[model samples]
Target chain A: MLNAIFSGDTPRSRPLTAILLVILVCLALGPFLFDGTRAFSTLGMICVFIVVVASYDLMLGYTHIVSFAHTMFFGIGAYGMAIATDAMGNNFTAILVGLAGAIALSVVLSLLLGLLSLRVKAIFFALVTLAVAFAFLSLATQLYNITGGEDGLRVRVPRELGPAFRPFDGELRGFSIVTFLSGLFTEPGNLGEVLRESVFKVRFSGRELMYYVAFVVSLLVFLFLLRMVNSPFGRVLQAIRENEFRAQALGYRTVFYRTAAVIVSAVLATLAGVMFALINRYVNPENTLDFQLMVFILLMCVIGGMGTLYGSVVGVALFLLAQNYLQDLLRLFAAQVPEGGVMAELVAPDRWLLWFGVLFVLSVYFFPTGIVGQLRIWSQRRKPAA
Target chain B: MSALEKTLDNKSARRERPWKALGKGPRARFAAFREEKPHLFLLALMMLVPLFMINPTTWAVLTISGLAMGAMVFLMASGMTLTFGLMNVLNLAHGAFISLGAFAGATVLTVWLNGYSGDSSLLVNLVAILPALGFALAVAGLVGLLFERLVIKPVYGDHLKQILVTVGGSIILLELIQVIWGPNEIPVPRPDALRGAFIVSDAIPLIGGIALEKYRLIAVLLGLAVYGLMTWVIDRTRVGVLIRAGVEDREMVEVHGYRIRLLFLGVFVAGSALAGLGGAMWAMYREIITAHMGDELMISVIVVIILGGLGSIKGCFYGAILVGLINLYVGFLEPRLAAVATVGLMVGVLMWRPQGLIPVIKV
Candidate 1:
């Protein structure tokens, strides 16, 4: 069935198939090779980010709307779930309710925004959305009673069917259960016991479990988006992007289509938010609604190549990896510096923002197509000669 | 073609009677009456309305501060609108230029006026005003030139690239500021001359016996002076004519043997310098300057521009005043909701007229 899906005579198909195969193989072996509870947790985080970035690209790249408020939707979903699960004290039901509420709110917001500024072109649209996001952030922070102000709201974990999984300790039984359900198996007895104890002892916190759950949800959402992107509706969206007026002239309801795209993207963002809330077991107004977070998501979409699904995934992987590990790597390098030296000043924590700014400028200027786009271009160029 | 010709004819007519009439239609006439010559009739009524109200200070502060702020915004927004209209550039980093001025002024006080403690000595005053204005204008102008040549020039007519480059430029400027000046907030002290409020009355029985701050009254006067000066420069000067022509058609102006590039450079420098001046004055008024002030103030400035309609000076003044009133009104309702109030105003205005309160004529 998958081969048939790629049966088109286009030259791009074979390379993409090969790439997919490699990814599948890696995914299959990832849990075992990486081992340890921390590694798995990291994988989950990457997956969640991938979903968020992918959705961001769907609106930005496909619709050609450089929305600065995408993170607001994510916040809505997260806060929704947080409010429901923690304040309302409903778990399973809350998840569904939160998802629905987020989607509904996103649709309304998108519709209103579309009605207001859909006629405005390009940068003005971006500015309007930026204003909206700022306004939303201020509103969120101002409503301290509800959003817990800057400190944010803390959430309690939902009860699991069995005793809650422990990490880096003798939570071997629980770890085994999770691994088994996730389609992985381990040797029984002392080795399993040792692994389980290590995992539980290492703090198999609520964050790690949320990571797994987030990964599963993200995978499902990604596949659904992938399928949608291949559909006729997605083609219309692409058409709108290429030439909006031309699309409108063709008797298409351009605003409706664009608004629909925004809403769909918002729903996906909200899903990521919910998962983020689940993982962190906390949701704050600042965490989800800040301009910095919005800019970061935008950076991912821009760096990944705004319109492509694969690009978003690649962008997410690169961004999350750099963000999480780069500091540590820099720290290690800093440690080698002679004490009280200029080198120490260069690697100081405050100076990290300088590096990020430089990287942002470089990436926007030089790597506009990002990693996946560049790779695809390279492959295409190489193919003609081949 | 007729519409174009009609617009041209209307432009000529406007030039003949530049200050003759406020606007056409009864609604507009009423609005102009309310705004331009309200004659303290409403001020008296406002005084009476606030009578017997607890915390009358809040009302007095909100009213006077809102008016002062409105005037300040009018000046800043006028420059911003003209630049945007003529240049077609959003100028995302405009706020940075403003902060540069504020920092320059504050630094001058710290370094030069550290020990001087006199009331309106001409020398001390010159020390404060000259260094602040000169440094602000020079640095801001140079930065403006650099920005236009190196950054904005390439991105002309390309909105996305402009946004990206400008936003990146903003971040770079922000970091540079942080590097030069530490992250702590710096205070800008008011000169002894402008320190105290005017005593309207020792005892008044209006608005339930409210007393307004004197500094705010002085700020209002200064704001009016600045506004008058800007209006005079824009409307009565030869440079103003060239600017008006350039805004209408840069190509036409170039074809007429004028150097459009020099005009643009001059305009950019002037805009930046004006922003700096506003920032400097605002710093003294607010008494604090921080790295993040640019970002905070930029939101409202952008809102003012959007509401007034980009590129229209008259629009900017009206929009600023309207937003200022809304902000004060909302601040009175709930201080925390002040930001939201501005946004709500923007959203409402956008819904009613997405082109803004004053639509710029597109060439």
Candidate 2:
């Protein structure tokens, strides 16, 4: 698929490549640019959402299948890791086992649901998947012995990947490798003490390591999906979406193709879930399998533009930026308002959802094609005029 | 001569078996019954569950509880069925109205606690309750009107846009509710006259001991009354015929000089009002109210409609009852399956009848 598209090495896509490069640079330097792990953590979250939402696009945008069970696959990934960490011990090998288990489980579940629901009307399929997802959520919460119930399970990250630690108890306590390295060349110390502390201090905090890992894996997943979407097989899925009967008449086995698409999408979602668990170091039903998360994914896809995979990137970035920063903006406005005044209510953080709701409605009303879609149309129109 | 002879023979054969005109044997009879009362078979099947459970008294108690719970669900779900059926509008924000109704009822009850306090007679308590119910219905209905005009009117035909817009509307409404109601779960105080249970040692000889909550009994009655009113409005009136006609063919009805748009708006408002009523009842049943209560309840309502068959009133009613029974029964039998039981029932029903348990004929 990559060979079919990017292999052409067309100069027209240079701008997109540049954009990707800039984003990569910004993400790699997130720790320094953002001043702390908080911003890095947010960026990591955005990365996770990007992967998951893009995977959602595979079904919704490409295959034209609307499903509510994406979160079920996501939850499968998180719970798989949670269970594996407890039983197999929190090692790199355990993570690998968890990933493989999650992938297999997601594929099977997606296949089963796709086959059963694809037999119905498209609308009915959505409803049925919703029912199935709710059932899965209930099962996860109810089976406390296996799933750890509603409180969720805290994953024991490998020591090197855990919180930053230090050797010396005084000023050096909680010092990390990043800080140590920065001061290493500036300060002089006893050779023996320096050597001893260097070995101990040369460890990445859990969050920092998880951020780098999530960023790279998300990029790989995105690129892989991009390849899949460009392949002939992907074209067949698109064909099924455009005209299932025509595809079937052409001997395309539409059901098999559709089911395969669902499996691929579900697998990607599960992979995203694994990254989420690694970064958060915990797994719970609400965070992973909740219906609200599914709604959020849907919202992101719609806002980003349904068919364009890159829109997932734009959508997640814009959404997270707004959700995270808008509160700060409101707080600034609130400071200008008198205490217990009418304007204060308007600028309250609790009312942020109200403003967001309005923004969402207005955006859908005005930009039905979404940001990427509108840009695509604008460019196409400009070409003819030029 | 041969054709005439054959015709005469066919006529003579038909005359010999006149029962064939009505239908053939038990299969035909059963088919007719199934068509007329599609949910009866399902109801009968569900009833057999208790026989397997083997504790008749427990079954009796559970059945009552199920009925009470089902009634609450029906009140909320019926409104959604009407709106979706008549308008083809998927109002995901319908839950917002339910929560609003609950809040409205709570406000009225709180403000009039004196009327509801102490050992007042049921009649006097009804005086206090009636006003709360009325306020909820009116306020919710008006809000529905506003919602229809501002949010729903612009995007009538597009299902995708409808979903997005309605979700946005729901979020806005939920947040507004928090702003007004103080972002916490408020306790709903039951009236003094409706607090205790009606205990019977020998109400039925087979069931030695039976206890039924007074409030639940009232809820069942109230739900039945609402159901009766809705059925009557839909089945027995000229407006009902017109609404049915509009659903069948809007253009044809418009050609006949009927304003279908007005009818649609009216139905939407009424549906919202019904949701509000249901919300009040549910708040009372739970004895607590939260802004997001309506949103959470929506999953069950959607499941009920799906199980009952979309656009089907009787199906919604029957489906609600089935869900209520399944939740209770499964919770008792296997606690793990309780949460998923309603969905499982939906899947099972769809497997047998893919269209739903009772597919409504739109025309």
Candidate 3:
């Protein structure tokens, strides 16, 4: 049953498995567990980005294809959602239409990209994709009448997905572990107080409902990726990555498989984009199609550990945690220092991307295998030398 | 030789001495030149776009500005191609250096050289700005050296790691630039001499009725000068010869007792300095500087290099000009479609020449 759920591939390390479980539970209980708007947004972003980053791993890690145009498909998906909803009204049908359109576009575009891209070497693929990404952005920006230009579009999610659309009459009562954890050390004997008095009122509303939607879809997609990777098709992809000429010599249509990989990955990424549009209720170039987002996705794939589906979970949780809480940490650190200097500016919240970027370089240098890889290594070492 | 053979095969050529045309040399030399640099004819063919597409005056002006833009791009791209050819390091953070130079030059021009920036004297403007450009170059080159050591040294032969680390470095450095310069766009101050267009009135004849910017002319000159110097050094100088030889066969050059590593380092630094210079020039051309400027230009720069063929200098030149002209021309003709068209042109070029305009080596 466990193997069936994991698609025959499991998180091999104890710590990794625990972390994955914790992330899954926390996200599954996010609205009930967390109160802050920023926390909710961050959670939603993490959920969406996990799928995006994981799909990218399918390309970069599994197939050794480095595409700077991952965000292009992402943008296309968001725009499709935004445009379709705008044209057809914010209903379930509109979403399905947008999603179907995005998928179709992604299929054709990724096929064209893969066909053109596989002809060139890896380096050329990166360069060409970068150019193509910019071209797409230009197209999006210029087609302002359709895409709303630089301002982007506010996607009117389905009425059921809207924040005000509560299913219940009032907020439903739930046990408040979040409150208990925060106050537990301060007041040890107040666990009952935290749970009783109906301390937390969890709304079975559309916003929380949207988070659950993102979570469930992400989980399903991640499992599907695991299944895909473990399949024979995946083995051929790995073989092609290892040695394309050898795979070709073995009579495998290498181009077909590589193109399939690109399409699968793109479809997943586009799905993530749809999730982004649904959750955020808005889609813009700056938000959906930023090149920096690609860097962040790359960071997730690298730090989580490449070629491991479970790594995306670890990566998304840690990076999102840092991105959200790092600012507070910096604020505390900066408070002790003098004002108006390079030190202050360096630690400014605006420069978080730099800190993460530095971490990316350091991780590439020092921890190329990443957290999951390292954990796997340590776990194997301890397990009777297995 | 093929042309010579064709002439020899003809009865007319058999009656006369075949060496007659060969002795005169200009026509044969032109043919040889055509054979050697087939893409130059492509460049010539593109140059003829203005004859039917647009008015002569507008065309001439656009061409000059386009060439100037190409010159700036060439400075940035030649460094990349040279480094790629010599060392096989892609250096995506080359854009970061450009950002560094722009900020450095912008600061210098607007602050330290403020007095001369507004001066009417052409010589004074040049004199004041030269130091700013130099300072920018120095700052960028020094950072490139550090970037190479910190981000690149570990991932010497791994293309994947090199690309990742370089990208990582680019983002970090761009952020660091913001940390220093603040996350805001800084307007570049142009000296009185460099400001405004030099209007060539119709009274001047065939080239009349065109307006050319003084800075653009200088940019074109500097670009041509750099191209000449690079070719000369590569063809003539010992270090250049060693670098070329290293590109062709590294072990052979090493066997001949030259430290290719030091030469590689030197080239890397020089390439970085060239990028810095280009950045400084670009800042002036746009009359604005921002942290993201280099990042924005990088898309076109990569396109230019790809079209030119990676790791080839002359190809970088023509590719830069072709991209610059295409962008400007199409932009002039049809607004908002330039970027897509540029990408389309890249795809078309790659299809025609999988390697590039100049075949450096197999990718």
Candidate 2 lDDT tens digits, A166-187? 3224431232344356446656
Model 2, docking class: acceptable
Looking at model 2, residue A191 earns an lDDT score of 46
DockQ of 3: 0.70
Specify the poorest-scoring 10-residue window by lDDT in model 3 chain B. B13-22
- How would you order the candidates by DockQ, starting with the best? 3, 2, 1
- Tell me, by lDDT, which candidate is best: 3
For model 1, report DockQ.
0.39
* Model 3 misplaced regions, further than 4 Å: A175-177, A189-198, B1-38, B204-206
Order of models, best TM-score first? 3, 2, 1
Q: Provide the lDDT at B206 for model 2.
A: 66
Question: Model 2, residue A385: displacement in angstroms?
Answer: 2.8
Give me candidate 2's TM-score against the actual structure.
Answer: 0.87
DockQ of each: 0.39, 0.47, 0.70
- Off-target runs (Cα >4 Å) in candidate 2 are A1-22, A164-207, A236-253, A341-343, A381-383, B1-36, B112-119, B201-203, B361-363
Taking the true A–B contacts (Cα pairs closer than 8 Å), what share appears in each candidate?
0.42, 0.63, 0.81
Candidate 1 per-residue lDDT over residues A94-121, each given as its tens digit: 7777777877888788777766667564
Instruction: Please list all clashing residue pairs in model 2, or write none if there are none.
Output: none
Residue B285, candidate 3: alpha-carbon lDDT: 89
